[model samples]
Target: MKTRAAEGGTGGVRRRPTLLSNAETWAQLAVAARIGPEAYAAVGTAAEPGTVLLTVNRPGPGPVVVEAPFGTRLGDVLHACGLRPGDSVLVGGYHGAWLGPVDAAGASLSRTGLAELGATLGAGAIVALPAVTCPLGEITRVAAWLAGESAGQCGPCRRGLPDAADALVALATGAGGPAGLEDVRRALGGAQGGGACSHPDGTARFVLSALDVFAPDVEAHIAGPGCGRPVLGVLPLPRGEGARLEVDWSRCAGHGLCGVLAPGLVRLGPHGYPASTTIPVAPWQEHGARRAVSQCPALALRMRRPERGPGRLR
Candidate 1:
């Protein structure tokens, strides 16, 4: 396994060279080395041989880590994680698709099997969204986050994604009316390809799948009254690493855009300044917070991800 580079630049071709792979790949190789390839091949399918580490999240306190054979049924995996069959599950992660009850139950943990149902076993993360929370709401929340994650180097990231995300927000809130679906479709189509990175394309895939899998909810929100379910922030975010919004009062010209963008999290005082310079942003509100910071005219608002304390290294 010739590696691209070593600690420095690609080490000039040597008689004997060090092999390089990701931590997971190296770890799996170690297992195969210890047990031998023949024994390792006996576990999973022929094509996708050996076991996979899955981070399974059901309607529980925390995620459960399990090593499952590649060809295992997703239903069985969910059951092992205390999820019932026919539950709505987010296969893969934010970039992945949503599988309704039927699809989720019939899906397999294999790459080929999951691909059949229009999903990939991305990072082996399977999340069973709770029934109490709104599926559309969760999708909207993630869409906003994805939109905010754009690097802004490409047209799709700079324009299309945020537009699509706004449409999604409008759709979820029942504000887009009958044109909601069309707006989302148009924006997604524009954002689908030709990006500097895969962010736009992946986000489109995620939003499209969510719309298909949760069509009933989409119809309800668009035409009917509502699902009456709250966005409980069920999906996990890396926000625990610490993040917040800071307003530079000196730079702020009291534009009041932050308040309008993130109304709940940021409030405008009588003088039109933010009630507080520092705003604690929740995982669900992070997208809105980001939008507020970006849309701020004076550029006073900025995101602050606090530095994590160093842990004791043994």
Candidate 2:
């Protein structure tokens, strides 16, 4: 009988009815209220009014969040801020899609505008992936971050995210082969369904779009010894620990099973406890690691798989 709108609402916490708007939506609403309709309408399109904040990143003095009209073309916006004509853009933030120079040529900044380009104003951000950084690595980091952010409640999120992350790592590190791409795509498809929330689905969309936009980069990572650039960590994620292959410390009894099974990676200490470096399972060695994991007497080793998969959108 009561309501909660995420600010304590009509009811108290955990009341039956609730309405939740993301932080940006709430902020936009506040701005709209303060500015009044006429002034807001004067700045934007007829369909959507007022300004939207854009976090612009380029090879320059700033990545400041600028307020721009809703119907303004993104390319013009970039040009005004010093982006060259040929520079590529990735829209919708980490959870958004990549846009080529052409796709962004005359695209509007509104919801309807981006929808035409198969994108949404996700978190209202844009990043210019410079020519120097290895985009594959950046995407991988974002994917890994999303995987770690999971509540670990869904099967697909549990497996898919790590799998995707690993594939990205392998691809960037020159360890992933053809199987890495296959594994990534498969994980994305499998993880697309069945979740308590939209996190899995939204994350899938984000990664998949990168795959399409960065096909050349992906191929280069797959076909050879990497794309000749280091991962610049351009994409942002929550600071703490990134996603990792974890072990259940309590359950480990130092049986030496993991070391015997995956000798190259899992080393046993003097007390027979399994220890691993920050390295991941290589493509050729994954089968051995899986065998060791299945045979562990203590069942302590827990390697995170990459469900951080993406689909084509370039």
Candidate 3:
């Protein structure tokens, strides 16, 4: 789990200051300074009085970052990104909502506007799912990645996320049936408010929005012949170029030691074995992960750091 640096000096120990703002916030501040507050406020709506930067992703081209005034129509943004109005769009980012065709047609770029559609303009990311790829499959891939990215400090991250990912996988592959969709919902619901951080809540929002936006496609997989389309990996992931935990199944016994040492990264399955082989190692969890590897009785666990350079996401 990532430990947030606390503010203020405690017992005469001065801690290093941590700046919480992102680059976009800094850029916006610079623009507001240059253009003057009144001028900046004049362009956008009264309620949302400033331009926002959007990282728009569509088919054919790489993701593009553009700035637009708040309250710009979502459809216009799609058109500018080489997408049609009716295409399924993932708003915000990984922890954001999915907008169906009708919603996309009427939605605007402001926070209030998106909230009216039961979504949020979170991180100002808009991903338009192209017709060529399978929506459910893409959703499943993201859910799995989100599960892997869990900080693993709480019950929601340790259990709920992995279960939700499993349920989503079942639904996407046409093996989960109607009950599987319900299972996904239940898992997400179980995670809500159970964590100290917003990771679980944000993840639930993302997956639930996907279920709503891709309702027809989800139904097709459950009730009839599945969408037969391939899962073209269009969505961008954090480049896989870091240290991660891996299990050697051949040399291993189902000891469940990794789960004890690194609860956040390793979860035990029904048979008391690590559920996932390749688990993401958050920077804060490295010490625990090393301990788990060193103490594994069967010597089944190992830490693998890729030698390749950091890759970019499109």
Alpha-carbon RMSD of each model: 7.6, 9.4, 5.8
Cand. 3 Cα-lDDT: 0.82
lDDT over C-alpha atoms for residue 128 of model 1: 84
Question: lDDT tens string, model 2, 96-141?
Answer: 7777767876788999989988888877778777767888888887
Q: What C-alpha lDDT do the candidate models reach, one value each?
A: 0.78, 0.71, 0.82
Task: Please write out the lDDT profile of model 1 over residues 57-158, one tens digit for every residue.
Answer: 754568888899889988888888778644377777777777888889878788898899888787778788777888888887777667656666778876
Lowest summed lDDT over 10 consecutive residues: which window, candidate 2? 305-314
Per-residue alpha-carbon lDDT of candidate 3 for residues 1-314, written as tens digits (9 for 90 to 100) = 11234434333225444455788788888889999989989988999888889998855668889889999998888787778744488889988898887788678899999998888898988888877788888888788778767777888887788789877877887778999899999999999999879999999999998888889889988986678889898877766645778899997799888889987667677788986676666566788899999999999999977565665211
Clashes counted in candidate 1 amount to: 0
TM-score of 2: 0.70
Q: TM-score rank, highest first? A: 3, 1, 2
- Model 2 RMSD vs true structure: 9.4
Please tell me which model should have the higher lDDT, number 2 or number 3.
3
* Residue pairs clashing, model 3: none
The runs of at least 3 residues in candidate 2 whose Cα sits more than 4 Å from the true structure, single-residue gaps closed, are 1-36, 58-62, 84-87, 242-314
List candidate 1 stretches off by more than 4 Å.
1-20, 85-87, 240-314
